[model samples]
Target: MASVLDAGPFFHGTVAALQAGDLLTAGYRSNYRPDIVMNHIYFTALVDGAGLAAELAAELVKGVAEPHVYEVEPTGPFENDPNVTDKKFPGNPTRSYRSVAPLRVVREIADWTRLTPEALQMWRERLSALSANPDARIIN
Candidate 1:
């Protein structure tokens, strides 16, 4: 199975917040409408196949498989103010504004493909393979 080490820095923050039992809140700039600001406490991550399976198993055993997983593709670069100093806010010049492609939440793993066409084919294929792998343990 894969490990959490493979996830992005954002995933690391999410995992840390979950472990510390803290509310994860952040504001995100809108891509389509740059003037719009949105606040969110929930975020998703594209996890390594093996890592996800392992995490799902552990969480299910604990009765909390949370911070749901989803497949995402960034349509554009993450916009941020390059001049910022403080890494956390308005003081910090740079802020993660937004990405061109918005992330879609899928209830069933198979629904990942419905969000996009050929773009998500690779993720679907990988997930399908992982699901078929007998060695990958799924708690529920």
Candidate 2:
């Protein structure tokens, strides 16, 4: 099962978020081996928040997404440009934004959101069964 360590070791909020996101993503990836399908019980433990964790989990299921980069628009006129003198010239202002693109993993996220207490118990039981006997198929 996943564990949540104390956040005190990290002082900054951004750092904590990055660390959390990275660790969560990496941990999820590590479990998808050919011989083993990780049970929901462990996933439940790793989830920090119902919505957020579900979203992140879904992405992990789809594998890593490509990074996106955008170009920032120029604020001031360029010194070498003849357009600088053109009063009619409109500034080509642009801003760059990025997101974890290609969120195909979102499909897996539904499992967490749809989970009820009973479902959680079932997951725990399945995990226990799997642990007790790796060769046993707990689910069809």
The backbone clash count of each candidate, in order, is 1, 2
Residues forming the 10-long window of minimal summed lDDT in candidate 1? 11-20
Tell me the tens digit of each residue's lDDT in model 2 across 1-140: 43432221111001112311232211122121224442211211122233332333333444343111111111212121121113223441111111122111211221223446576457556545655775643221
In model 1, state the lDDT of residue 45: 44
Residue 34 CA error for candidate 2 (Å)?
Answer: 16
Residue-level lDDT of model 1, residues 1-140, one tens digit each, is 42322133232111121322223233543221223344432223434431333333333334443323333323223433222224334553222223333333222232221223353456446556755776643211
Pairs of residues at least 3 apart in sequence or in different chains that clash in candidate 2? 58-105, 73-94
Q: Can you tell me which runs of candidate 1 are displaced by over 4 Å?
A: 1-66, 80-86, 89-97, 104-140
RMSD of each: 17.7, 21.1
TM-score of each candidate structure, all chains considered together: 0.22, 0.24
